[model samples]
Target: MRFWMVFAWLSSALLLAVAQETVLTDDALHKPITVWQRLASLAEVLDDIRKQTGVPLRCQDALREMKLAVYVQNRPAREILEQVASLFGLRWRRDDDGSYVLYLPDETRRALERAQRDDRAATERALREMLRIAREWLRLPPEARAEAMAPFAQTREYPANMPYSAYLMEEAAAQRQMTQEQRVKALVADYLSGYSPQGEPSKPKRDAFFSEEDTQGSLLHCLSEAGDAIVNRLLEGHTLGFSTRPTPDALPLPPRVLLPFWMRHAQLSDESVLQFDAASGQFTEVQPLPNPDWGGYWVRLSAWGNSLEYMVVALRVYELDGKTQKFLNKVDYQLHLPHQEYLAETETWRQWEAWATPMEDWTARLKERTPLERPKPTVNNERPLLAADALEWLAWHTGYPVISDASRYVPAWYRDSLDSPRALLTLLSNDLWLRFDPNGYLLARHKRFWTLNQFEIPERIVRPLEAKWLAWQWLSLDDYATLAAAITDEQARGFTRVRRRGSIQFWTAFDNDPLYYELPALRFWASLSAAQRQRALAGEWIPESALTLPQRKLFRAALYREFPPPEQLLRDLPDDYEVGLYVPSVFRSEGVPESRSEALKQSPDAPAFRVLQQNPVSELSVLKYKDELGRRTYTLHEVKTQVSREGVDWKKVFQEAGYEGEPAEAILKTVLDTILQFALPPRMFEQYILNQSRYADFGRHAAP
Candidate 1:
């Protein structure tokens, strides 16, 4: 039997991502911390604190392995933390969101040193393994070796017009001539030659892994592994039968093992089976093995559900010798199916089911002459809208599911008269590149913009709240209910209970949204005059009170309360998913573009600002092109009308509508546009306009 045959029988395991529970109490920070403990590893203490506080701590793996002893009297966590840092000659800094990060002296230097050492060790181990495998393979009989290599020897052809087709064809023939043993030796020599062949003898040589290989040569090199071979078949523009099982070994048995395991242990006779050809991905009728005792196998393959990347395959093993046959075993395996091959094997409906529409179909749809509805957008006071969120909502209304994978959190607010699918799609294309595949799915790639990054987080979020800050405890039942609704989706209604110890200040946002919104609120407070700041600190400032009665109600109900206290809210909410503000920035900050942009740039450590500031080419649609002297020039297509076409100054609108403070102008503008154009509830505009102070007392006795 081939070594790979036994390799298939080996079992493997995967590690799952599980949240580590941490128990943190106010006592840890407020009460005296008394520690007269034995020797312990610094990592162990940090890990315990992490579990308790639910704050993640990251450090060098080397430092984690180091041990330390500490014995201290009653002290606060901060002081103890300082003392521990001093003990290790390390320093720590708290992030904008109050999370502490520890770093060692010359940490970068040490890290690089360790990485280099590890790489050298890894290379040596790989070299040894390759030498061992080469020796074993060389010992095998030539005929057995050739048989082992036969399956992978099949030539893969390219289209006649494709570039480098001849080169690939010639390379494939050379690969097919080499026996499996020779191939393995060549691969090993190829790898070892890198360390000492061209470079100095003292140091291992470094070079490209497959520098001499063209497309076909690369494919042959990769076929050392079964999974790679299957994937390569798909890459070669060929359909494949994916099987997950150990069939009869395709390679001939070793001369030493002349007596087969099946021959020694006769099981049963012939049974029904399926066969799959290696050369042409075709299935054949079941037939008895010429000599089952010599060990033959059968395979069957089928589509694996909705996955566009993998397929299911089953293999049945059988044995036959001298007029008798028996069944050995049956196994199943998953084969890697490339998207191209999957598309080739699938039908129109099947492809459309997974939100994958081909590019050609999208082009056709874009050019189709269909009647388009001109629907006016109305403002809705009940909910705040995010661009990605609005896109999904609109898609849902139009019978399409949009997958949200945007990098920035953009709130959209625009009024539009065009309700045609084409117009709506054109509008969305401005903010994100929507890749619609034949498989009924859409992927959203956001336009580049300077949003928030982890480092640019406001001080309020990173540090403990000041004495005047209001906590989640002050929120009402509706507020908590609304917040819970925002965090949930169709699948997860959210955790049944939120347990907070004292005034928990942990940050929940694992993305840039918080930085864009919450950070502005803190900056807004900082922007106020001393007198105004003092008044705000004295609790006289009522930002939400300035909003319309209905808007105010929704505003007060939109609190960030991911961690509720010991008491739980048992109130019932509408089963329909709620669309409301999850971040309080809408109510906290006055929209000011300059201040927002400045605040974003304040954090030199934030790479996101650079990303956001750049005008990246989000999407490109070519409408027309001309080729002149081999230099191709193309005309880019642009969407004529988008959410920004309304061009409404959101800051002025919010203020004139009696909102007290400035919202995050940048984010607010985006959200308002998205909502007005896509997420706004029908007929809500009248109520919204009536409530606006600017429109007060308008047509009191008019049509009801």
Candidate 2:
């Protein structure tokens, strides 16, 4: 394969060159210079080589051998001898018996032999020189080189009769004969003519139009005209049949032999069956058969949309010949819907049915002695939990409240922690307030503070509370009833009361605010044990408070002056000092009103009172600072509206906003116009108005 490939490549190259040359003019085919002048021109080359390598050039025979070696190694085999002849300024010709000859100059032969016998360095130098001479000789005009070494350069003969030269000559001749177009035409013609000497003749045909010769010719011609088309068709696939002659002494058909037949009916369920008359091969009746678990013998039929819609049929044939029953089987056959339609249209199925109906009829003829019964289907009914009931149950059990604040309106809840003030605050914010009975029992709750504006709380405590709530909600009714009963009875009368009055309050000393009244204060003072309360009251739990006004101011100044604490503490009181006047009138009058009035009257020479400075109040100042910051930092963009035919002119709006036609200005104007047109809700508007003040300065200096 490899040799043929190389041969094909070389042959193609040679043919291509010939074809190209044939189209060129004579001037384009420059005749190479004769060999002799080329050899003579080598003297200058030898002188140059000697200069480079310090070796004397010698011997025509040695030079010829070096040229031969180089040509053999570098050039392709066919071009080797020709290249050698060109290098030596010689031309080669084959003798009548076919042998290669090399002609060289007399002086060159002697010089080459002398160089060959020298030392290693000398031999290498000599080889280089000869190579240089060969190169120089190759450069000379073909005609000039052919004359210089005519006498000394004669053809030489090898010992044996090698056919390599003959082969090359033949190959060259053959390549010159055919162009690519000519080869294609010849190959096609030969194929069409059916000139194959290697292929055996196909079986002879009796028909007059299909004689052996004619068939072969026609097949070949068809293939030649459409070989690729035929191969492709065959590769795609074809249907063929193989017929074999049956032996004459075949055993009689088995009695009760099982022949599986598939029916391609449009509506045959798995239980559907067709009864056939074996003698007439015709279908008699159609019936549905009960599925049986008999091993190795079964039939399945299915139809579209029905459980048994698409049909697959199988059956076991039993021989019932006198007492000993045996089974005989045939290969299963499938009848597809499309194929069935074709067969039905062609009346094939009718014919097949006519022949097989008797067999099916006979097989199904047996009547069962016992009647079969089908089992009844079982039904179950159960109900799922209702969402409202579930939430109520969860709330009752876990002491948690559900709040719905999301747009989707899905209600969610978190378990309440009795010990966490934050949790209680969250509940209060959501208007889901809770209270305990006098004895610490849970009571009916109010949702005013817990559900109104509740915010998200931490998950760590919430999750446990939620779990407990869920568990309480899911507890068995019997368990809950039992607990309820126990609570109602006198046996549990000492338990915590399920109702408390003062627990829910506002705006008093026990108000639910962080400053003077909060859950921690209540839990610390009222809820803790006596010992714990005492310990906490003794300052272990209480943090030190900053000194009041005048005392603080005086201490601050004195400390700044670096006076010792003992000295500052011992300093005499100012003559006109009045501590009651220095305290805020609200704290003094409301917190210690009677005492403050009495002290003021007794101190008649006290310094006159100074009114407290009132901080400035503005619309922005009245708004919560954090709420303003949140509004500025977290955007509450209005829902975007669809474009209207008379939508606000963005360009005009941008101009009004002091933008001098910047591209994004138009977008910003459009956004603001849309926002203004949408009209926010009252609360949302307040928030937006407040935030706008904070961002107003930013908008004022922003780049257009």
Every model: Cα RMSD to truth:
31.7, 54.7
**What lDDT is obtained when candidate 2 is compared to the true structure?**
0.24
Candidate 1 overall Cα lDDT vs. reference? Answer: 0.30
Residue by residue across 1-704, what tens digits does model 1's lDDT show? 43442233221100000100021223344445443222234566666555644566545555563433233334455445544553233556555666566666574345335433443333333333343543344344545544443443434455544433234334545755775445545554443221111111211111111122111121122222233344334333333321111122232222222111122223323213334454553333232222222221111111211111211111123244554322223121221212222222222212123222333465564453432132322344222333544454344334433333222234443224124455445545445445553333344433321111111222222222211112211221122222333332211111111111111112222212222222212222223345543443342423433334543333322222211110111122112211222211222223212221233333233111110111111111221343332333433222221123234454454444444654321111111110000011211000000000001111121111
- lDDT string for model 2 (410-517, tens) is 121222232332332332323222222222111122221111112212222223433443332222212222222322122221111111111211111111122111
Q: What is the C-alpha lDDT of each candidate?
A: 0.30, 0.24
TM-score of 1: 0.19
Poorly placed runs, candidate 2 (over 4 Å): 1-164, 192-222, 225-228, 231-704
Residue 9 lDDT in model 2?
Answer: 39
Clashes per model (N, Cα, C within 3 A): 53, 82
